[model samples]
Every structure is written in structure tokens, then in C-alpha cells.
Target: MNLEARKIEFVQEFLKLQSEEAISRLEKILRNEKKMSENRLVEPMTQDELNNRIDQLESDFQNNRFKSSAELLAKYE
Candidate 1:
């Protein structure tokens, strides 16, 4: 089966879980897997890369390329 189908099947089985221990174990596994996946995807930035990003941000701020906090809040609201 495809990923979506497998996920649906897993959810259906999960919904039928009657044991607290089983549910807790699944939750722990899910949390650990999520953390592992995130760790795998993220890497530490080099000092030069970090400095370049800071410089770019400063340039953007000086050029007024960003919105104010009030403007962002108003847009969401």
C-alpha cells in the first residue's frame, strides 16, 4: 500500500487501542521519531554563513523591507 493508505490503516488501528501502556509507547515512539527526523534535517550553520545572514538582515532592515509588529498583527487579526 501507499503511504497515505498505510497511515489511514495505522490510524484506524490506533483508534481501537484499549491499553494505556500501548498508547503511551506509541506516543513516545512518535515523539522520538519526530525528534530524530528533525535532527537529521537540521545542521549547524558555519560562522561565515551566519555573518552573511546577519548582514543581509541588516540590509533588509535598513531598506525597510520588513513589516512592523503592528502591521503583522493587524494582518492576522
Candidate 2:
């Protein structure tokens, strides 16, 4: 079968799971896999590029151009 079909079949079988421990293990695996995939999407930055980005951020903060993390999150909620 194709990838999508296999995924659907897997989900169907997963839903029929009766063991709580099994489910918990699967949940942890899925979460870690997802986190790994997310981290893989970001390209690595060089040390000089990293320092320049940090410097720009500090300058922005000094000029009152930066938002706090809480403020940035609050807008989404």
C-alpha cells in the first residue's frame, strides 16, 4: 500500500489499542518524533551570524522596538 494508506491503517490499528502503557509509549514516541522533525527544519546558523542576530536584538530592545516573550504569546491567545 501507499504511504497515506499505511498511515491510515496504522491509525486504525492504533485506535484499537487496549493497553494504557502501550498507548503512553506510543504518545511519547510520537511527541519525540515530532520534536525531532521540527528541529530538523531549522538551518544551523554560524557563530558570527548568531552574534550579529543577538546584537540586532539588543539594539532593537534598546530602541523600544522589541516585544517581550509574554507579550508576543499573549497576542496569539
**Steric overlap count per candidate:** 0, 0
Error of 2 at 42 (Å): 0.9
Candidate lDDT scores, in order, read 0.99, 0.97
Clashing pairs in 1: none
Instruction: In model 1, state the lDDT of residue 16.
Output: 100
* Worst 10 contiguous positions by lDDT, candidate 2: 59-68
Model 2 Cα lDDT, one tens digit per residue, 1-77? 99999999999999999999999999999999999999999999999999999999999989999788999999999
Q: Which regions in candidate 1 have their CA more than 4 angstroms from the true location?
A: 47-77
RMSD of candidates 1 onward, in order: 7.8, 5.6
After the best TM-score superposition of candidate 1, give how far the Cα of residue 22 lies from its true spot, in angstroms.
0.2
Model 2: CA > 4 A from native: 53-77
Best by lDDT: 1
Q: Name the lDDT value of residue 4 in candidate 1.
A: 100
lDDT score, residue 23, model 1?
Answer: 100
